[model samples]
Target chain A: NAGVTQTPKFRILKIGQSMTLQCAQDMNHNYMYWYRQDPGMGLKLIYYSVGAGITDKGEVPNGYNVSRSTTEDFPLRLELAAPSQTSVYFCASSYSGARGSSGNTIYFGEGSWLTVV
Target chain B: AQRVTQPEKLLSVFKGAPVELKCNYSYSGSPELFWYVQYSRQRLQLLLRHISRESIKGFTADLNKGETSFHLKKPFAQEEDSAMYYCALSGRGGDDKIIFGKGTRLHILP
Candidate 1:
């Protein structure tokens, strides 16, 4: 399977511009997440969803928004993009929470590198 | 707040030498710890979990509750083992939200 798929492997947005990072999973995962990876730093959670229509904030959710409208899709929206948002964004999914019922397996899509100028 | 700490940013070891990556976590309750690795240009993937007490790719990690540490070790390092490693922590039960360390870039010298 394609597993988790992310779009626009690379993008450069002008300051104040808006864009969306699309993510999808064919495994019918109930949990989805968005994370940003900065150079020399760990991946920071931006937003995550437990299931459809359920979204929660993560450590760094200031400039990002996410919606899990369907089990297969969780798209991250960037409004009024800023330079600080420049980083490699990763989208991941799991059947359940990492240590929860389903299992501790998380499948990740190829990261999307965003640069804000 | 849950936190995962990896003190080293880069670690270089000669081929066939022993290697260890240190990780410490701060959590009040029983936690689920994990090791994630990313090879050059490859997607990040799980290496092992503390709960399973299993070994992967000749690497193993033992979770020490008293010390709040889970260090990944390999008796003999290989060039293929060179990659970025991250230690992670998650809340008990199914709270998929995990906290990750800054990550350590491992370099296996030939």
Candidate 2:
């Protein structure tokens, strides 16, 4: 099964343009997240959803929006793209539970590279 | 505020040599720590966690509460071990979101 799938592996957008980064998971996980990684920087949480119909903002949620309509899909939308938005975006999913000894291992997609010019 | 830090931006070692990637974190309460690795052209995946207290792929990490460090170590570096490693932390209460460090790029010379 495809653990997690992200579309538009690479995209280039002009300033002020808007686009959606699609994410889907087949694991039926209850938690999904969107993160962006900049050069020499760690992944910063953009948005997250605990379950369908529930979403919340994370550390770096500015200029982004997310909606969890179903168990399989959680997409991130950029209202107005800027140079600051250029980075590698990753979609991840994890099961919500007691988090065993290994803790919750979040599965990530291959990542979507977005370049805003 | 909760934060994770990977001091080294890049680390290089020869095959069969021991390696260590330094990581330090700051959190007031008990925190869950994790190590995530990204191989060439692949998605980032979990390597190990402090809670597991187990080794994976010949690599191990120990959390030192006094020093607030969770450094990753491997006895013998392998060519296949070359990758980017990130240190992350999760808070016990409040928002259970994970925070990651800048990451260290480890390169093993064959």
Candidate 3:
């Protein structure tokens, strides 16, 4: 059972290069999130989606973008990549009831290691 | 704004020793705290949450509103328990996003 899947488990890019980190879930979860983990910064939220066609910015969404056109897919796009973007990115999903009234536990995917040289 | 603070960046304990990982948060809404663990070369996963008031893998956490802390504790730590621990806080509502603190790397020595 694939809980949450992220593509390009490892990647390297030059400064200013752009790429999209693909993320998808098979659990029919309504909430999806993208976060970046740095050495001392912990995990910083980049973007999130509540459901199909609904997306919002998180704590650190400056150089990143995300789309939720369907329930099963929520991809994060990074434009004009920079050195600070070199960190492990994680995609997570949770199935809270309507308005997230229940089951707030989030499931995380094996992270995508990206290095912006 | 919400914030999670994990004081210790690295913790070393002997096998079978009682271990405690400190965690503090600053949030005004009803607090929803959780402890996440990541073993060496493994993905991050949830260990326990205060709302459940339950123990997992011999670890438990209690939410203290007055102190604004949710520390993870284990009476007898095993070598297998050596992993990175993170403390997190949820927004007011359940579905709201979560804020995580810098993780603490726990090393259980023999």
The sequence of per-residue lDDT tens digits that candidate 1 reaches over residues B1-110 is 78899999999999999999999999989888889999887789999988888899999999999999999999999999999999988776656566789899999999
lDDT (Cα, tens digit) per residue for candidate 1, span A1-117: 899999999999999999999999999888788989887666788999989999999889998889888999999999999999999999998765434333557778999999999
Q: Enumerate residue pairs that collide in model 3.
A: none
A35 Cα displacement, candidate 3 (Å): 1.1
Worst 10 residues of 2 chain A by lDDT: A96-105
**Alpha-carbon RMSD of each model:** 2.1, 2.3, 2.5
lDDT of 3 by residue, A2-111 (tens): 99999989999999999999999999988899999875446778998888999999889999989999999999999999999999999999875523334467888999
Worst 10 residues of 3 chain B by lDDT: B90-99
Model 2 steric clash pairs: none
DockQ of all predictions against the true structure, Cα-based: 0.58, 0.55, 0.49
Error of 1 at B23 (Å): 1.2
TM-score between model 1 and native? 0.91
DockQ of candidate 1 against the true complex? 0.58
Top-lDDT candidate index = 2
What global local distance difference test value does model 2 have? 0.90
Greater-TM-score candidate between 1 and 2: 1
- Chain A TM-score, prediction 3: 0.93
Docking class of 3: acceptable
Error of 2 at A98 (Å): 3.3
Give the per-residue Cα lDDT of candidate 2 at B67.
99
List the candidates' TM-scores in order.
Answer: 0.91, 0.87, 0.88
Scored against the true structure, residue B72 in model 2 reaches a CA lDDT of: 98
